[model samples]
Target: MQTQTKTQFDFIIIGAGSAGATLAARLSENPEFSVCLIEAGVKDTSPFIHIPFGLAFLARLTHLGWSHNTAPQQELNNRRLFWPRGKVLGGSSSLNAMCYIRGVAQDYQRWSDAGAKGWDWQSVLPYFIKSEKQQHGASEYHGDAGYLCVDDLRHTNPLSQSFVNAAEHVDLAQVKDFNGAEHHGLGFYQVTQINGQRCSSAKAYLSNAMARSNLTILTQAHVEKIIVEQGRATGVQLHINKKTLLLKANKEVLLCAGAINSPQLLMLSGLGPKEHLADQSIATIVDLPAVGQNLQDHLDVLVQYRCKSNVSYGLSLAAIPTYVKAAYTYTFKHKGMLSSNIAEAGGFDKTEFAGEECDIQYHFLPAILQDHGRSNALGHGYGLHVCALYPQSRGEIRLLSKDPQGELHIEPRYLSHPDDQKVAIAAVRKAREILAAEDFKPYQAREVLPGAEVQTDAQILAFIRANSQSIYHPVGTCKMGLAEDPTTVVDENLKVKGMSGLRVVDASVMPSLIGGNTNAATIMIAERAADLIKQEHSSA
Candidate 1:
C-alpha cells in the first residue's frame, strides 16, 4: 500500500450516510473539535436524489448506489436478494423512499432490556425531538424546530387514499399520524421531505455545517480500514483518487457505515471473530465475535392487483398525454403525480397471532412495484407490501477476503425461523383482506401476485419464499449490549468493547431492529452519540 501525507483531526467519521452526516455536523458544532467525514460515493447533486418521487430512478443508478447482493439463501430457494445502499453525500437517506418513522416505545425498551441502557424510549425521545423539524409543530412527541424536516406528503394520489379507505374498511383505525401517541393503527406515513423535495441528512445537517472551518467533508473516499494501535483506534486508511492516505484521529474514530459496511470495515481492520479473520488471513486485533452477527431486516412480500381505472401510476402508451400534463403541472406548482412518493400511504397493525404490539407493517404503493422497482410490469396496477416487523431469524456479514475493495458476504437468512414464516403467511392474508374491502370494490380488478388459487397455508408459504424481498431496513450487525455478552460489539455508550476511542453510532449498533423504519432511529442515534462524545471529553 502506497502511503501519502497524513491528515489529522479531532474526530474522524467513516461513511457519511444518515448517521455519519448527522454526527459530523453535530460534532463540528463546537469549534473546539475538528471533524472529518469520509464518504465512498460522490456528491448528492443528482436531481433524482433531491426530488421526492425520483427514488425509482435513483435506485437503479449504480454510480450513486452500493448495489450489494446477499449470499444465496437456503430458505428462499437459494435466491440472492438485491440490497441497494446510498453512496452519495447524504447516504441512503438521499435514495430512500422518504418515509419518516421512529418505531414504537417497546422497541427501545427491548434495547434497554437487552443491555443498551439509557437508550429507552423516554431517554431517546429527546434526541428524536432534537433532530426533527416536524411540520405539525411541537408536541410531547415531536419537535417544531430542527434540521431534519418531517412533514406529510405534499400530494397524495387518489389510489393511495383508496388504500387508506380500504384499510379502514377492514376494521383498521384510520390514523392521521403514525408517529403520534399510538403506533398500532393504519394511516398516511409522514416523510422526510420539505416543500415536495427530499430533505436528506446531508441536506438537513451537513448543509449548514459545510461553511464551518472546523469540519472537513471528503467525497468519494473509500475507507480501507480503521487504524488500531495498542488496543486503541488511532486513525483510518482511505483510498481516494487511486492513492492511499492515512487520516489520524486525535480523540475518537466513529464508524457510521450502516449495518453492512460497518461490520465489513471492522472485519477488514481485524476486529471481528477470530476464526473468520483467520480464514481471510487477516491478523486479529480485537477477536470480537459479534462484529457482524445478528443481522435483522424487514423481509417484505408484495401483493399486487390490477387496477380497473387509470388513476393508478403505471406505464402505458395511452398515458403519455396525461404524464405530459402532469409534468407541466409539477414544473410550475410542484404538486401532481410527479410530487408523489409512490409509496405515499401505509400503516401498522397487529395480527391475531401477534402480541400487544404490532407485528405487521404495510406500504401501499400507487404504482406496481416489483424487484425494488427495477423490473417493468404490464398494465396499470397498485400493490400493498406487507412486512413482518420483528423476525426471529439472524444473519451475518463475513469478509470475502482481506482486501477492503473485495465484496463482503451478506447473509440475511430470511425466513429461517418457523414463526417468521407463520407471520409472513398471516400478513399476506391480512393484506388480501384489506384489498378485498368494500372501499376497494371500484378499483379492484384481480390479484396479480400469488393469484386467487394460492389460498392454502402451504401455498402462501411457498409464495412468500419465492417473492419476499427486503424493505431496506438492515440492522443489528454490530450490536450494542452488556459487556459480559459475547455477541455485544459495543456498550451502552456505543463504544466498542475492549477498545478505547472507537464507537459505532449507526443502525449497526442497534441491539435489536425497531418496529418501524430505521432512518429516523439512526438520526436519533447520532444525536445521542454526539452528546455522549461531548460528555466523555468534558470529563477528561
Candidate 2:
C-alpha cells in the first residue's frame, strides 16, 4: 500500500465543534499564522441545519451525530443509555436545542478554588459576555457586540407560560435572567439563534473566517492518533478518503475533539496511563492516569403532565401557523416564533440543600417529552425536566482495542451514586409539586408519566431509575487544574501538563459540568484558551 503525503501547519486543531471552530477562527485572525482544522464529519450544509425547529429531526441523526452509547449502568439494571453528540461542523452546538445559558457565577469560582488559576467567575465572565451579542440591551454581564447572537424566544406556547407560572406558584421565585448576578429562580431561556435560524458554531465563528486564505479546513478527516515525538506533540495521523495522511504541526497541536474523543486520542497516541497503554502494546509517552477518568454528566428526569386545555405541543397542526408566523417574522423582519428555541423557558434553583449556590436546573418544555424515541400525546401537554446540576458519579473512557480506529468504551456510570439518584428523585418530586400548583390548574389536566396512581416515593424512585436520561452535558474527562491534582489533565493555561506543544481546549477540560446549558460555557472556554495560546506564543 502506498503511504500518503504529509502536510504541516502552525497550529492543528482537531474536531470543528463549538470549541474547535471558535478557537480556529480566533487564532486564525492573524494572517501570519497558518491553521489547519480537521473535522471527522462533513460540512454543515443541510437546509434543515439552519432551522431552529429542525433540531428534533437532527437529534437521532447518525451522519451528523456520533450517537455514543454508555456502557450499561449497573444501577439501572445495566441499561446502556444513548448519548448523541454532534459529529458535524458545529458539533453538539449544531444539533443541540440551542439554549444559551452561562450557568451560575460560582461554577467558575469552584474551578479557581480547585486550582484552575485565573478561571474564577470574575475573570471568565468577560469571555462569556464577549462571546454573546445579546439581542436585549447590554448589561454588566452581557454584551451586544459579539460573534454569537443571543436572542429571546419568540413563540412561547401558553402551556409554557403556565409552566413558568406554576414554578412561581410553587414558591420557586421568578427570575428574569439566569445569567445575571442571581441565578436562582424561574425565567425565560435565551437561545443561540439569530432571526429564525440556529447560530451554530459554524454559523457563528467559522462562517466569518471561512474565506481566510491562511486557514485550511478539512472535512471527513478522521484522526487516528496524535503524532507525538520525543515527548513533544507534533501533529496527527488521519484517514481521509480511505488513505492515511500525516499532518505535522509547526508550532502547536490543539485537541478540541471533545471529552470522549480527546482522551481516547491521547490513549491511542500512547499519552495515557502507562499500564493501560502497555496492555494494548503501545509505548507510553505520558503516564497520565487520570486522562480518561473523572467523567461527569447531568441526568435529567422529564416530569410530563397532560393539559386540560388544547394548548399542548400535540397541537402541532394548529401550531404550524404559529411557526409560520414566526418564520415570516424572521424571514422579513429578523424576529418571531421561528427564532424561538424549542425549550422556550426555564430557570435555576436550589433544593434547600444549604448550598451557597443553586444546584438544580430545569428545562421547561411546552410539549410531552415523556416518550424516549417518540411521543403519543392525547392532548395539550408539557414537560418539566429536573436536572441535577452537580453530579458525583464519576465514569471513565477506556480503549476497547489498540487500533486507533477501534471503538472506545465509555462507562458514564449514570446514577451510580445513591446521592445522584436521591437528588434526581427529589428534583422530580419538586417538579410534581410544581405541576400540582394552581398556576397549572388552568392548563394541566392530569399526571401522565408517573400517573395519579403512582404517588409513593418508592414508585417515583423506580420510575426515575428506569426513565432518567442525560441532558447531553458531558465533561471533566480531561479535566483542567494544577499539575498536582490527580484528575487534572491540563493546567490553568489549558496546556497538557506532562506534554509540550499540546493543549486540550474544549468541554473536556472543564473540571466539572456547569449549572445549565454547557454550549455557551464551552464556547467561552475556547475564547479564553485562544488568548492563552496567543499569549504563550507571543512570549515564546
Candidate 3:
C-alpha cells in the first residue's frame, strides 16, 4: 500500500473559515480548478456549533476559537481585552450571534470613494443577493436559491420583541427588513439559520462541497507562513500531523486567515513593514508598509438592568421548570428557547455625530451577559449592547515575537479618538431611552449598569472606558485600496500590492468596517472574489 499526500493545487486557500469556505466551494464548482482549503482548527463537530443557543458555551470552549488577546489598551483602563476569532470551519460565523445584515449602500460607496474601484454599493449588492437563500423569497434585493440561508429567527424571546417596541416608542421607525430599502430602524434580527440550526458558512458552503473530488479540505493544519519566492507568493509552508509540508499553489495562494492572522502570516512571510520586519530579523520580501496597519473594530458597552419578569435567559434555581420545559421543546421540536440567538433584537440608527447615515448599532439580549457570558449571572435580567458603529481610532496588529506560532500584539486602540467617546456616550444614552420607554415599563427593572446616580455625560464616558468590549467585528488590518496609497496592503481586487500570485480574501482586506455584523459581508466578499478568480482562470 502506498500513502498518498496531495501537495499540489491550482489554488491554495488558507483558513477554511467564512471566505475560505465560500471560495473553496465556489472555485471548485468547475471541477477544472483544484482548490485546497486549510483550517487551523479541528472539524466543526461540536454539537454546540450547530445549536443556535449553544454560543453561550462557545466562548469558554477555547478550542473552537483563536485565543487572541490585545495588548493593554491605554484608553480602556489599560485592560487587555480577549478577542476571539473562530478556529473552526465556519470561522466566527459558527460562533457569532448569526445576525444577518448587509450594510447600507453608503458603506460600499465609502469603499469606492476610498479608491477600491469596482466595489461600490450597486456593484456589490448582486453578490449579496447571489450568496443568500432568503426565506422571504427572491426579489430585486434577495435570492432564494443560494447556499447561505437567511431567514427569520425560529425563536425570539418576548423581551426581545419588547425591545423593538420600545424603540418604536422612542420614535425609531420599525423596519420589517434591515436589508430591504431603509437601513434605519429597529426590528427582530433575521439570522443565518435553517430549521432552528445555525447555518454557519461551513454548513451553508462547505458541507455540500465536502465530497467534491476537486475540493480538498484540510483541518488541523496550521500554516507557518506563506512561501514567497522572488516577491511572488507560490505556496504555503505548514505543519500538519506533527509533520511539516510545503504545499504548492500553481496559480495563487489566497490569504483568508482574517484580520489578525492574515497580517501575522504576512509579517512572518517577510512581507510587512520594512522596519517592523527588521526588528524580528525577517528579510523584507515586499517591504509592504501597510501589511498589518489600519486595524478597526467596534467597541461595545452593555447597558444592563434586572428584569422584574422572569423571561430573560438567565440560569437560576427558580427558573428550573421553565428550563425543563425548554429542553423538552428543543429535543422534540428543535424550536424554543434553545433556538434563540441571545442578541435577538437590534437596531441601526444614526446618532447626532453621524457620518454617512448611521453611526450607532444596538443588540438587545434577553439575558445579561457578563464577561462575554463566561461568568454565570444566575438571575432574571436583560441587557442591551450599545456599540459605536464607525470608530475614528485605528490600530495595528504586530508580531509579538519572531516565532510563527507565537502570540500577536493585538491593539485595537479603542476610544483613542475623542470622537469615539462621544459616540459611545450617545449610544448608551439612546439605549437607556429605549429601555425606559412605555413598552418596557411593564417589565421595568432597576438599572444594573451605570445606575441612576450616574447621570452626567462625563460619568457615562468613564463607565464606557472602564467597561467596553469588542463586538468581534475586527477588520481593515490588510486594507484594500489603490496600489499608490501608502496605507493599502491589497488592491481593489484583493490582490496583495507589490506581491504577485497572492490575494487576501478576508475581513482583513476591508478598507473600513461596515456598519453591521461582518459575517454576511465577508461571505459576500468571498462570493465576489470567487467570481473574479473564475474570470481570471476561465481559460486555464
User: What is the TM-score of each predicted model, taking all chains together?
Assistant: 0.98, 0.94, 0.98
For candidate 3, write residues 25-103 as lDDT tens digits: 9999988899999999889999898888998889989999987889999988999998999999988889999999988
Clash counts for all predictions: 0, 1, 0
Per-residue lDDT of candidate 1, residues 1-540 (tens digit): 223344999999998999999999999988899899999999999988887778767767889989999999889989999999999998999999989999999999999999999999999999999999999999999998889999888788887888888755787788887888876767788999887789999999999999999898898889999999999999999998798889999999999999999999999888989999999999999989999999999999989899777778878887788789988987888777777778888899887779989999999987877668787765788889999999999999998888887888999999889999999999999999988877677875789887999999999999988888989999999999898899899999999988998999999999888998899999999999999998777434
RMSD list, candidates in order: 1.9, 2.6, 1.5
- On TM-score, the leading prediction is 3
Superposition-based RMSD of candidate 2 using all C-alpha atoms, in angstroms: 2.6
Instruction: Score candidate 1 by lDDT.
Output: 0.89
| lDDT of prediction 3 | 0.90
lDDT of each: 0.89, 0.83, 0.90
Model 2 global lDDT (CA atoms, 0 to 1): 0.83
TM-score-best of 1 and 2: 1
Q: Record all residue pairs in model 3 with backbone atoms less than 3 Å apart, i.e. clashing.
A: none
